[model samples]
Target: MTRARLKLNTKQIRARQRAGAVRGLHKAVNHLHERSTAVAPIEETTLINSAVASVDEGALRAAVSYDTVYAVRQHEELTWRHDPGRQAKYLEGPLVEESAMMLELIRAQIRRSLR
Candidate 1:
């Protein structure tokens, strides 16, 4: 393939990979929901718990911690010449912390229900 075509192909592949990763995460989330609700086989509950436990804590934190609504004012303050590195560090870190806490709450609820 030509150089330009190769770059285009790479971009397409990256996009597809991103979409597939998102779909997998969604499926995992849905599986947890189903298992918690007892909509699936009992054996699947173990699988769902395992899957949720296996999610990388760092990645989960990174995904949810960057809430625009909560951080809008902070973002605006630094916008004249924003540092992407600093922004990522500031905005993403706390979001990740909140996500971790929420995940723990969900896990606790699941545990309580199983009792």
Candidate 2:
């Protein structure tokens, strides 16, 4: 009678999994930041460049920010850029799509790790 034997280091496996999850999170955040910047209205380039993304350790969530004095004016500028009567949802639309994509990516990563 013969039996197969396997050796597993749980600590090492857990470390690798954590590293992969972190990498996936960082990738998602970076993707969001890039998408936001691309969709942002740019005249002087300051607003677009101000877009930034980071992961919150406490919440394990990705957070994005457009840290600029004129961040509040984003809506007004986008809305009135083409026509004052119609609102141009440049930032919000792209952000929603990007967020969905990022979520899907993370889910895929999780599935892959499980395999």
Candidate 3:
């Protein structure tokens, strides 16, 4: 009979877990940005192209935004007319509709990173 024991460092394990989580968060944010862009109102493609995803590592938070002068107005104005398949609240709609999938994306990335 043979017996073997292996010792693992808890600190290293924790760091690895945190890194995995952060990677997941980044992926999640990018996922949101992508989905939002797909449904975003496209006027000369300015708003769609201006989309950006930002993650704050220390705060463990992320945001997807469109950097345009009229971005807010375009997102909020329900009365304004857009193309047949487009309308106001483009980002908000996607954020709500894709919430579940986004979370899954984060979880999957975390698992992958851990491995």
Candidate of highest TM-score: 3
Each prediction's TM-score against the native?
Answer: 0.28, 0.67, 0.84
Q: What TM-score number comes out for model 1?
A: 0.28
Whole-model Cα lDDT per candidate? 0.38, 0.68, 0.86
Report the Cα lDDT for candidate 2: 0.68
Write candidate 2's Cα lDDT for 1-115 as tens digits.
9999999888977766665576678778888777766666667878767778898644567777888897767644643563232233545666677878887767666556656
Q: Find the candidate with the highest lDDT and give its number.
A: 3
lDDT of 3 by residue, 30-105 (tens): 8899888887788799899899999988877899999999999999999998887787998999899989988887
> What does candidate 1's lDDT look like per residue over 21-112, in tens digits?
54454444444433332321123234223322134433632122222333445433544443233332333343344455545555554444
Q: What is the lDDT of residue 74 in candidate 2?
A: 66
lDDT of 3 at 100: 94
Clashes of each: 2, 0, 0
The residue pairs in collision within model 2 are none
Question: How far off is residue 111 in model 2, in Å?
Answer: 3.3
